[model samples]
Target: MGQYPDAYVQYLVHFHGDRDYFECHEVMEEFWKAHPEDPRSATYVGLIQIAVGLYHSRRGNRAGAVKMLVSALAKLQPMDVRTLGLDAEELERRIRNRLADVQAENDGYTDINLPIMDPGLLHRCQTICRDKGLVWEAPSSLENDALIHKHTLRDRADVIEERARQSRLRKEQGEAR
Candidate 1:
């Protein structure tokens, strides 16, 4: 197994395979929130921005794409991509190129194919993708027409119930104190 967390691996797989930007954000965000003290929080957010930015681009939201990509580039500029087991120079070059493409706003969306330097990590990601019956390195798409916008069809009951449960717990604890 690689030194990275399962969440990071999941993020990579969803990124390279399913191209589910929203899912990428969820996995990475959960990891970052769980380990807030880690220096990788910014890194995770940058990765999230890449996914969301691509999603926006694919959906033809030029303005949102530009904003997210710009923010991602700025966050990643100061960090060494190798810390996340990637080729530092190549990753930066790709991001720079992507930023330019996004700024031009001609194409709908560009795939963010980051270079992975770690063989083990790459292998693990590919394996996960295969296990999940997805194609690696394939550009993601909202092919499920009805599922294009997740919130429009997803069930939010569990999330709402969990939030209410947490709220009740907090209130009970406050009263006890």
Candidate 2:
């Protein structure tokens, strides 16, 4: 019991890495039974569910794949994967791609093309645009001007004012009196 979490975690890594979905499910079940109240248990359970979904996906079980993957995604919603040794972005990409493939194979399912944009890139662009006093346009299909302004504009009115003041001072110092 003392080493259950660590041991189970190792097993999970091995099972998922090796694509042994059945063993992944069994190993995580052991951990879940022991650490039923553990806050981090959801992460492990979500991983196992994802592995099971991947296994079904690879074996051409579209219904099972969709069911398990959706469940896995829901289970993962409450936890940050960055602190759990899981690459959340990569997992999302994989899940989205897999779901798209499944949707393509099934009827009455809409294909979703999720944006792959990095949040960090968006933040950097916002900062640069704000500092430059340039208008920023967030990529959106709607043509509403106010919506565009609301989403893209950074609240940097104070910084812009300060920079203008500094520039005025520099200009005044350079002027001949």
**Cα lDDT of all candidates, in order?**
0.79, 0.57
| lDDT at 104, model 1 | 80
Give the poorly placed runs of model 2, Cα more than 4 Å off.
1-4, 106-177
Q: What is the lDDT of residue 113 in candidate 2?
A: 20
Candidate 2 structure quality by residue, lDDT tens digits, 1-177: 112345444443334233345555667778777888887677777767776675566555688878988887877743345544445777777776777778577543222222214454334444554565543442222243332233235476887899999999999989945
Please, what are the lDDT tens digits per residue for candidate 1 over residues 1-177?
A: 238888988998988988777788788888888999987777778888887787777776778878988888777744545777888678778877877886786655557787988999999999999998999998656576432465356688999999999999999999999
TM-scores for candidates 1 onward, in order: 0.82, 0.51
Poorest 10 consecutive residues of model 1 by lDDT? 144-153
Leading candidate by TM-score = 1
Clashing pairs in 1: none
Candidate 2, residue 35: the lDDT equals 81
Positional deviation of residue 110's Cα in model 1 after best superposition, in angstroms: 3.5
